[model samples]
Target: MNIKLWIDKGFEILLDYGPKLIMAFLIWVIGNFVIKLITKGLKSAMKKAKYDISLSKFLSDLLNWSLKILLIIVVLSTVGIETTSFAAILAAAGLAIGLALQGSLGNFAGGVLIMIFKPFKVDDLIEAQGELGIVKEISIFTTKLRGLSNKEIIIPNGSLSNGNIINYNTEGTRRVDLTFGVSYDSDIKETKSILMSVLINHPLVLNDPEPTVNVSELADSSVNFAVRPWCKADDYWTVYFDITENTKIALDKADIEIPYPHQVEIHKQN
Candidate 1:
């Protein structure tokens, strides 16, 4: 008799809880399907609108996960679980998390600023945070760069955004400023003529700036002339290197010697 009574009590418990369990499960299932559909639809729309792939994917995933969490909370509440205390605890936990990740949050904000303002893009050579490199990637917390020597550098976005950035590729053309020094005795007019000839003949040099060749300074050892030439950004280094080497050759051919610092013999009162 006791066994039968226990069995009847168990059946009553199942009957009372079965409908609630089924309803909770249905809510979860339906909510999950709805979330997936909405997320996919939004992603498709954004893609069709030519949105950034990374941003679209991130937004879609965040929305889906958030909706899933809300659905789970609703399901739990339907099963008679106390949600007010749970929500309070979650709020406190979120606050603590935010405080702990203050720097990361700043980086994230800086990253947003970078994306919006777009000071530089991938493969752009830039100087930021006392480092110079080509930008490799821009993430939520940091920007990655690969140096000319193949070294990898990671800079926090906050520092990068706050500090000055020199973007070498911002303009289509760049000026290559070179200073060449010659002996004090060398004819300045002849040297200037030779430099002008080389610059004018070079195909890469732009004509608008007119290839400035002027006496920049008189040093202790020699007289220096500034050679400023404008060329396309991609060809700046190549043109600079060629012009420097060729200028020396041309000066040598013209018998203009480059000065070397040395001590003069003032020996002998003895």
Candidate 2:
């Protein structure tokens, strides 16, 4: 009699909740598939719109997570949970998490601002916070930099957006300023001419602006000539290094002495 009674009670319980269980399971399976399809369609649209890579990925992730969370709530409600109470609990949890992750939120906001304003773009040589490098990638939390030394540097977007960024690639052309010192005895006119010859012979130097060579300063031991040469931004370094070497060689062959600080010593006659 006891076994028959227990079996009857079990059957009654199954009859009461079996449909709800099946419904919840169906919702889970079908909701997940729909979410995948929606995310795929959104990605395809983003690609067609030519959205930036970072922004497109961020939005897609946000939508995916949001949909998944909603799907969970719907599945729970299908299983006979009170959805109003569940939603209240979710709101409270979201507030707590938001407060806890304030810094990350700030970084996220900064990333958004960076993407919208576009202060710097990929491959641009920028200097900020004493780090000089080319912009590699802009992520949701950080900006990547490929340092001139071939090292990778990661800077948080929060500070990067607020800080001063010196972009060297803004202009198509840049002027290379070089200071060369000659001994006071060296003829100023001849020295200037020698420098001009170096600039004129270099193919990278632009002729439109006309390179300026002038005596900028007179030190106690040397006369400093300011050599300003204009070149395309891309050829700046090549022209800089080449002109420096060629100037030295030309000055040496022309018998012009490049001046350096010298300490003169004499034996004191006591």
Candidate 3:
């Protein structure tokens, strides 16, 4: 008699919950399929919009997880579970996490803006946040740069996006500003001619802009001539060092003296 009662009780419980369980299972499967289709469509849209690869992947993953969580809540509700409390719990947890990672979220938002607006790209020479370097990688939270000294620099995207960004590659050419001081007695015209010749003779210097040599200042000990040369962006440092050395040689060959301080000693004989 007890065995029969136990069997009846088992059947009664199954009858009460069997349809709900089946409905929940069906919802789970269908929801997953729809979520996948939605994610696939989103990816296709992003690709059409030419979104950055990292950003596309990150967004797709985020959407996928968020949808999955919603689907879980729906399935639980279908199984006769209270999902309002569950959703509230999720919302509270999300708020806490968001508060905890406020800075990171800011950086993530900045990175998204960067990827969308594209102020700079990988391999471009940029100066931002008091650092100058070639953009190495652009991630979701930070930007990596290969510094001029070959050091790897990581900067938070939040600050980088907010700060001023100078992209040197945009113009394809850069002006090399230099100053050469000559003896006070040196003829200004002669000094300017010599400096212009040095700039014109250099192979790397651009000729269209026409290098400039001007008397910038007359100091107590010497006269300063500003020498500005234009060159390809990549050849900046090379042209700078070459022009400096070549100017010294050319001035020395021309008998133009660069002034130096001299100290005369007075000897007393007892």
Supply candidate 3's per-residue lDDT for 206: 99
Give me the candidate number with maximum lDDT.
3
Residue 33 in model 3: shift from native, Å?
1.9
* Lowest lDDT block of 10, candidate 2: 46-55
Q: lDDT of each structure?
A: 0.87, 0.90, 0.94
Residue 252 of model 3 has an lDDT of 98
What CA RMSD would you report for each candidate?
3.3, 4.1, 2.5
Per-residue C-alpha lDDT of model 2 across residues 80-189, encoded as one tens digit per residue: 88899878988999999999999888888888788778788888888997899989999888899999788999988888888999988888788999999999889989
List model 3 lDDT by residue over 5-115, tens digit each.
999999998999899999999999999999999999999998998787888999999999999999999889888998998899999999999999999999999999998
Model 1 pairs in collision: none
| All candidates: TM-score | 0.81, 0.78, 0.88
Question: Higher lDDT: candidate 1 or 2?
Answer: 2
